[model samples]
Target: MALRVTFVLPVFPRAPVGGFRVVYEHANRLTALGCQVTVVHERWREGWSRPLRHLREAARDHRHRRAPHRAIDWLPVDPRVRLLIVPALTPAHLPSGDVVVATHWKTATLLPYLTPAHGSPVHLVQGYETWNVPDPAPVHQALRLPFPKITVSTHLTRVLSDLGVHSGQITTVPNGLDRTTYRPPPTGAPRAGVAFLLSDSAAKDSRTALAALHQVRAHHPALLARAFGVAPRPRDLPPWIHYAQGLTGEDLAAQVYRPSAVFLCSSTTEGWGFPAAEAMACGTAVVSTRNGGVEDFCHHNQNALLVEVGNPTAMANAIRRLLDDEPLRTRLSTAGLATTATMDWQQSTAALLTALKAIS
Candidate 1:
């Protein structure tokens, strides 16, 4: 008999975010492996007056009017996978399945109410998401729910351990790279520029990255800079830096990583930093802060140049070092490519399936 698995998601963004992408990939791969996979999306609701709530929903809908309706539009989702859209997340809104997975802390908080109809839930801890919630006590309490936990990086595992989850209850499944899409360019001579991701979120620290880029430009005026993000282009961005909005994965690989001399990541924390790994897979050297997740694959002075968080001067120095020393850049790029070569979706998905089977 095929295993019936359902994943509960808080909201589906039009643009591809790292955490959502992981959930989509697992659903698609599990469907291909003959599991009955279903994705349930719950729209976020505000605890305001009905009139105000409707207005907020209308604004959100208008903002994403150009976005696609289904995951298949942007990602490679199997047709066999079923999608369920619900207005709100409640016990009555969910479907009973052999296994239920909560993709975020908000959903995890509701698992206790769900266990009677469904089964012991599986909490997929992608990051330390307490920072995003208004009342983190609920998120912390959810972490202690009697359920199996699967995390994406060593950093997340450590976080769960700190939250009092035993080592036996948590499983570590690292994120994988799509080798087909993110591989080295045909010829390895990249243009004289650097690339980084832009975001409005505080943790992404886009301002620090911009500051570091400004410092790099002071010394190397000829150098170019580019940024890609799902957010609207900020008016404060220097005219010299090229900005691209809502780029697809293929476009990002071709336009940003493949052509850039180096990729920069200034995130303060991550469950697993996908941009750095993807850039390295495209054979670009990376200069990133010690964002927890990147530590899994990024070895300082080997596969990447690591610096402390919020230090723009150190980030600028690392970027300058790579730009000036071609030999060092080549070594890091070569090593980075090798590091990601072994990380494939197939392997990671198989590991996930094994963990699921053990618990189920």
Candidate 2:
């Protein structure tokens, strides 16, 4: 019998995000493997307590449910995979399946309420998730649930252990690189510019990235920098740093990843660093903070330069070093490419299936 897997997301993403992208990738691959896959987007959660805000969001979700295809036009989802936008995470809105997976801490809280018909419940821990909520007590509580946990990094496994999840109950399934979309160009060109992802989230630490760029610009006055994200460019952003909003797939590779000399990651934390891996796959050297997300594939002065998180001066120094030494940059880029080449969606998805089977 084919496995029936259903994923519950906290909400439909209004824009492209790493967490959502990972789910979509797994859904596509699993469908190819003959698994029955369905992704449920909880339109209205308890977090939006205000009546006006709740009504507004519910109305938007109704529009998406009416035309589900347009809701995720930004992502490449398999048409065979079912997409559902529900009013809430109630059992009444969910379909029974072989196994139901929770993609967020909030979604995990609802798993216990689901009957056996909803299938075995499992929590997919992409990050520590303490940063996502104002009060982390609930996040910790969610981690402590008896449900089996699937995490993306060693750091996250350790975190779950601290929260009292048994080591045997936790599985690590790292995110994979899409080689077809992110790879080196036919020929290398002069790529003097630096690139990084921009986000409104404070945890992404875009301020630290900007500060590091400022320090680099002090030495190389005409240094070129590019940042891309779903958010519009902030008004205070310096004109020298070009911002490209919502670039993905081939366009992202051609515009931001391929032409960059170095990719910068200033995030304080992550379950997995998707952008860094994609950039490395494109043969661009990387200078990133010691964020847990990148530790899986990045090495200090090997595949990429790793610095302490939240330090603009140290990140700036590493970026400067990569900029000054062409040979070292090429060496790191070559090594980075080799490192990411082994991380493929096929391997990660197989691991995920194994984890789900164990819980099921």
lDDT of 2 by residue, 119-222 (tens): 99999999877775789999889889998999988889988998788999989999888899999987757687799998878779989999999999999899
TM-score of each: 0.93, 0.96
- The lDDT of each candidate is 0.86, 0.90
lDDT tens digits, residues 1-360, model 1?
887888988875657788888988998889888899877776646545687876786566444433324434568677677776666778788887778889888888777788555744799999888665678788788888888999999999998898899999999999778889998898745456899999988889989999999999999998799899988889988888899998868888998899998999999998899999999999999999998999999999989999999999999999999999999999999999999998999889899988888877
Q: After superposition, how far is residue 321 of candidate 2 from its true place, in Å?
A: 0.3
Highest lDDT model number = 2
